[model samples]
Target: MNIRQYLDSTYLKRAIQAGITEKENIKIVQGFVREAIDEQFKLVMVRPEMVAMAKKMITDAKSQVDIGTVIDFPEGRSTVEIKLDEAFKAIQDGADDLDFVCNYEAFRNGQVDLVKEEILKCTLLGLKHHKVVKWIIEVAALNNQQIIQLSALIKNVVMTNFKEENYATVFVKSSTGFYKTENNLPNGATVPAIIMMLENASPLPIKAAGGVRTYEEAVEMIQLGVKRIGTSGAKAIADGAVSNSDY
Candidate 1:
């Protein structure tokens, strides 16, 4: 399989998180953009503030790699207005795709309507701006039933509110790659979780982010119908090298 095109080639860690200076962190993101250009992967996923820089860098390099950003990242507890504002900024900053951390806690708290509304508004924002919209359900934070329910919610909202031709423009992604767990377990995408998402979120594409460290794991997800794979070690994966990216 030509796996490069399916890779998002991600680097979402911040300077403070890595104990580096902010300037150094951005340089790393810049390097990621350069790598994405050289590898011809799908895109480079970064924090919102870096979208414009990545855009300019890709433009100057004469590369076709798109730029994507996260919204309500790691945690989905942000209010809808705040999320939308962040998304608008990212859109203006030249983000080609937007991955939103859905209000998972709200849904789990029996606030299903609020969760559905958040999905509807965010999806509409991305579609109207001509960008792909992906929702990170953070599967590790929920039980199996919650995963199934949330996936169904995304698929239902999209089908009911969006045009049939645009269904593929949105995705039900697996994780944010940054969720903290109590048991020190795997906190990102897993095989069973991806399978659950694929089975539940049908027509909507799946972007399996987090913990997809190797080419074989990524290829397995793709063969199972995952439309996108988000990882920081894309170069190694494409070259058949192994590296356990901390995502």
Candidate 2:
């Protein structure tokens, strides 16, 4: 396949969720969004505190952009109420989508009910605002069984939403860039696993994230059935800094 054509065909979504721990990072994120617009790419801005600023940037962009925010980010350790509140506030702030980090510990501890409840909360909130909600499962932290279980859980959630006539999309995502192994390897999600999850997913879309930093890798992901991408290196990848062989 023609690399550029493949990249363009698949939705190239950029993420700007640099946490609110620093001021300079915020400026850099804003600059990234502006530059992404100049390059004509779809963007998903993900800082909880920077949602407002990100929305403003998207609104002011010369080209169209898809604005999104992250809830229960990197940790996914927040209370359900807190996550719901964050989801509502983000939608109210004009975010087009909500990328929610699933409660990894809950899933790890066999708290499937709690995990489902948290995802349901976000689904309801997104429905109220007519926005899309992508659930980040932090796949790198999960074993194959956990990944399969999460897929089943998400399938059930999608069915429930369908019964309620709620039209929110459930997205299985990889990493938040928090955990890493002793090998200095980043603990983010992978494309192959995401595709496997999607093969078992009922109706939700698969969004490949984390270490996707090159045009070729992006194309390979799309061929694997990923509909959206979440990466901070979108500009670099699109500009051909990273190679597909890196994957």
Candidate 3:
């Protein structure tokens, strides 16, 4: 099967996060962009600062690899206004897909209205510009019930506020690939988590991000009905090897 098109090849680490110099980090991003161009992955997911660089590289190569960036990143604690500002900038910088980390903390605190408001506003901003939007619910940080509720919440917001034709463009994604769990637990997508999202976030697509490591795992996600898989090990998975990427 051609799994490449369903993959969002990713590299979201910063210099400090990756334990490298700033110049070295940039060099890695550059190579990542080029690899996406050559490999023709559906999109290249990067930090906001690298969106324009990825865009330029893909444009120069005349490749079809789309550019994606995260807003509010691993922490979904940022206010809606700040998330909007970050997303707006990413869009202007030529990102074709915007994955905003959902304010899962607020949801956990029972601030449903706040969560709904941000989902609606941020989603509208993305759809208005014809960009694909994915809400990262950070499954690692949420319980099973929270995952179902948040996924359904995002689906409700998209369904209630947007046109039917636009539903597919907005996804309820699984994780941010950056959440830390206690005691070396899996910090990303798991079967139960993806299933909860799939069942709850139906009409809106599902993008299983984080912790997916092998071709078999990717295929299993696909068979279980994930529309996309976001992983730093896109190449390794595509080549049928076990990926060593922490993300």
Highest TM-score scorer: 3
- Candidate 3 residues lying further than 4 Å off, grouped into runs, are none
Which model is ahead, 2 or 3, in terms of lDDT?
3
* Cα-based lDDT for every prediction: 0.92, 0.68, 0.94
Query: Over the full model, what C-alpha lDDT does candidate 1 score relative to the true structure?
Result: 0.92
Q: Work out the TM-score per prediction.
A: 0.98, 0.85, 0.99
lDDT of 2 by residue, 138-222 (tens): 7778888888888778878877755534432556666565555567665655765776677777467777767777777777888
lDDT of 3: 0.94
Q: Supply the TM-score for candidate 3.
A: 0.99
What's model 2's TM-score? Answer: 0.85
Worst 10 residues of 1 by lDDT: 238-247
Sort the predicted structures by lDDT, highest score first. Answer: 3, 1, 2
| Residue pairs clashing, model 2 | none
Positional deviation of residue 246's Cα in model 2 after best superposition, in angstroms: 13
Give lDDT tens digits, candidate 1, residues 1-247: 7799999989999899989999999999999999999999998999998999999999999999999999998788999999999999999999999999998889899999999899999999999999999999999989999999999999999999999999999999999888888878988899999999999999999999888888788889999999999898899988888957877
Candidate 2 ranges beyond 4 A from true positions: 1-21, 163-168, 243-247
